[model samples]
Target: MAHLGESIDVDNIVPERGDFEALPAGPYMVQITDSDVAETKAGTGLILKLTMEVMDGPFANRKLWTNLNFRNPNATAQRIAQEQIKQICDAVGFQGQLTDSEVLHFRPMRVQLVVKRDEQYGDRNEVKKYSALNGSAPPANKPQPQPAAQKPASSAAQRPASGGQTRPWGNRAA
Candidate 1:
């Protein structure tokens, strides 16, 4: 056992636990915050684990996770994983070769998520698809035209600054 160096004040702290409920099924804008390459359960394959965070809306900052079996013992699983990787690259407009997963990090993209319930592991969100945040890739190092003096119609009218830069929440601050 370990002893505390100082006295504690439990009464002043909030007692509520964090909500673990699965997010409702739908498309969400997110960015890959982290990625890792690890061995599969059987120890015969490798998987790319990606951790993403919602960028906007009420669920902003919520985390979502997915694993791609890039080097699996099963041929079908490996093929599917490879295809998913390709789709992610295409969505982010990553051309040429991709040797590191970190290249995909911090790029905002849209993901279709569905809730899957398991008796043993509880419910979790599964990534169905990956796409560019907008219909097309964001401008890469190109200058954005300044809006006219007139007020913009809505939030949708706002655009990120040049160099494909965007705030962590996937929007430019007012």
Candidate 2:
């Protein structure tokens, strides 16, 4: 162990509460920060685990996880995963075959968050939907403009200045 020059007070350090609280579910500007293919909990199939970070809004810097089971023994699960993957690809304007590296690349996109309730685990955030930033359907053949590598701005800066309203919980009207 290295010697300290001065005595430090451990009690003076304040723990950050945000790290423990669940982010209120709602639409957020997010980016894919990390991803990997891993075996399912049951050890029966593979899943693509995505770690997404909220780039803006009230819950900026918070993380939300999403798993896509593209290689499952169950046909329905595979189909649903494929569909969701297609939707994500379209939203991000990615063309051609999907690869693990490409999917892991950092890309900003809009995601709708929803609360999923479990009897044992309580409530958790889930991705409800995805959309292009321009509020229009992604072109079938054309690729959307990609932003350069840089720090993402807050949702207030990215979204329209006027209609900046956000509903954290669910779609229950404010």
The top-ranked prediction according to lDDT is 1
* Cα lDDT of model 2 by residue, 14-35, tens digit: 8886654556767788878888
lDDT of 1 by residue, 48-73 (tens): 99998999999999988899999998
What TM-score would every model get versus the actual structure? 0.72, 0.67
Q: Give the candidate number with the greatest TM-score.
A: 1
How high is the lDDT of residue 92 in model 1? 74
Off by over 4 Å in 1: 7-19, 138-174
The TM-score of candidate 1 is: 0.72
Clashing pairs in 1: none
Query: Per-residue lDDT for 38 in model 1?
Result: 98
Q: Model 1: how far is 130 from its true place, Å?
A: 0.4
